[model samples]
Target: MIEKDIDVLVGERLAYLRNKKGYTMRKVAEALSIDPSYISRIEKGHIPSIKILQSFAELYEVKLSDLLESGDGVSSIKIEVEYEWFEFVETMK
Candidate 1:
């Protein structure tokens, strides 16, 4: 089983990125063609799948470690939530 903290960290990263990219939940859902609630759930750590995590990393154009880490001493990550990210998310589920 994946550790709980990993899910939490990933979720935090999701929110950080979503906000950074100026993507509202609706926009993200529309981009992904998924319900906004799904995005909300993932960002809240209610979903756990390495596949989803991998998709998220590619979506954000960052390494999985970056998404997992808080970028304290690490380089800050700035990314645009892209159209492909949603495609990747769909494949994971």
Candidate 2:
């Protein structure tokens, strides 16, 4: 899938998870020590840094992979491939 498509999917998933956990963007931003605008940007398809994504996963008590997965029939294999790519990029950093 295209990178932008992945970004949107991740953003949607993030929003869903945040809502499910009863967190406002401000609350998530405060807990993650980031700007609330950043959370809005993420929800609007701005890809966050790996560190930020990891922080979100921890705060939400979810696996990092869960954050990357989309609810809309995206295959697990595809998600896994993307996740491995993310892990590789993180390791390189």
Candidate 3:
């Protein structure tokens, strides 16, 4: 898939999951310590860092691969996907 395709797919999945979980964009942004506008941008097909995606997946109790992979379409190309949880949290030094 092209970069644009991936962006749109991820964004669609994010929006669906957020709405399914009954979370407002503001609530998610507040949990991530980011501006709500950033979340809006993300939902509108802005590709963010892996860490940010991971954070969202962890927050919503979703597999990061689920967030990264297309849910409705099958790609003939074999793409190996991997993800790790990097939940947004602060730790004392």
Candidate 4:
């Protein structure tokens, strides 16, 4: 994939995780001690640094690979199911 495609893919995954976890961009920014506009930029396909990506993974309680994973058809389904299970487990807590 080209760099732009990768950026959008990663951004989509970040948005998905944030929405799944019921967090607004403002909330995520506060938790990560960053600006809300930074999170908005990330979700709008602005590339993030490895440190920021790692922070997102940590905040979402997912592996870094999950954030970087390409969302091509079948794997996307698997990711959705996995996240659903995670959500269920969270509700049980």
Estimate every model's Cα lDDT from 0 to 1: 0.66, 0.77, 0.72, 0.74
Reference-based TM-score of each model: 0.59, 0.75, 0.71, 0.71
Candidate 2 displacement at residue 63 in angstroms: 0.5
Report the C-alpha displacement of residue 76, candidate 2, in angstroms: 10
Q: Residues 1-93, candidate 1: write the lDDT tens digits.
A: 333454555677788877877879888777666688888998887655666666666666676656754575332443334667556645654
List model 2 lDDT by residue over 21-44, tens digit each: 999999999999999999999988
* Candidates 2 and 3, the one with greater TM-score: 2
Which candidate achieves the best lDDT against the true structure? Answer: 2
In terms of lDDT, which candidate is stronger, 2 or 3?
A: 2
Q: Rate residue 84 of model 1 by lDDT.
A: 71
| Tens-digit lDDT track of model 4 for 63-86 | 776765554431352222366644
Instruction: Give the Å error, residue 25, model 3.
Output: 0.5
TM-score of model 3 (CA atoms): 0.71
* Models sorted by lDDT, best on top: 2, 4, 3, 1
TM-score of structure candidate 4: 0.71
Tell me the spans in candidate 4 whose CA falls farther than 4 Å from its real position: 1-4, 71-93
Clashing pairs in 2: none
